[model samples]
Target: MSEVPSPRLRISDQDRESALTALGEHMSVGRIDIDEFGERSAQVTAAKTRGELSGIFADLPEPHPLLDAPKVAVSEPEKPAWADIPPMQRIMGALLPILFIASIALIITTGVTWWFILVPIGISAVGEGIWGKGWDNAHKKLGKQRRRELDG
Candidate 1:
């Protein structure tokens, strides 16, 4: 970015685009005024030679991208365990409420008391989910430990 490129050298599309991008960054950060940015941007787009492109940015400092990277991409972040809304929880959450309402209506109409069976089933389902999660965590930990043992 130090040496102004050869003035008379033919420019490539990439060179023009790079200059245009640099101009945009400079304008966005208030290094140059909007009018200057617009004028230079037009000149950059129409520039046919490396010198014409270089002249547009001759007075400006290097753009931000040239100074430092904006961001480094790491691996995609994982969703937390709690954020993983399981399908069974979703289905049963809705079904439980509906079942409770139906149980109330059925008891009021028939006094049969048989629809109450779903209450125990719902409680057991919750316990199963809690236990299942514990088992999964324990299983993963054991797997890691086993791998380490084998590697050692």
Candidate 2:
């Protein structure tokens, strides 16, 4: 009632529907007759502005359109995919750059070219960190295949 900011504000289908529902409630309570309900319902349906709806409820009490506040749903904030990784895995993932740097330093100092071996290890560590236990299953499958090859 008093909440409507302006009389001239354009009404929506939802607003009209709310008014119609209120009118129906009024009719059911014997506040308004069927013919009067029909007439008021038509008026409500035809209402294009808040002003047009205001007069329809002028004679009625309590049950009015657009009086109750609409409800809003609140949701929890989403976490990033990396946030779900285990703490140990996250630590290993973080140390991957240091692994590469140390490998490169070893390669430069020793000139043995064995630093190439660290690349796969660093890649596997980071992959396990990001993909979690899924990487362990894949690693197991690879190991099984190698074992079958040796046994055969």
Model 2 spans > 4 angstroms off: 1-4, 71-152
On lDDT, the candidate that comes out on top is 2
The model with the greatest TM-score is: 2
Backbone clashes in each candidate structure, one number apiece?
A: 0, 0
TM-scores for every predicted model: 0.38, 0.45
Per-residue accuracy of model 2 over 1-152 as CA lDDT, tens digit each: 55647888888777888899889999999999999999999999888888899989999996899733473468886554445556665555566656777777878888867857568586866687777646534434445566876797
What does candidate 1's lDDT look like per residue over 1-152, in tens digits?
A: 57754668776666666677888888888999899988987887788876676667778888622322234467986544434545555444446546667777877888867757577466547746765543323334445566876797
Instruction: List ranges where model 1 is wrong by over 4 Å.
Output: 1-5, 64-152
Error of 2 at 33 (Å): 1.3
Q: What is the C-alpha local distance difference test score of candidate 2?
A: 0.75
How far residue 55's Cα lies from its native spot in candidate 2, in Å, is 0.8
- lDDT to native, each model: 0.64, 0.75
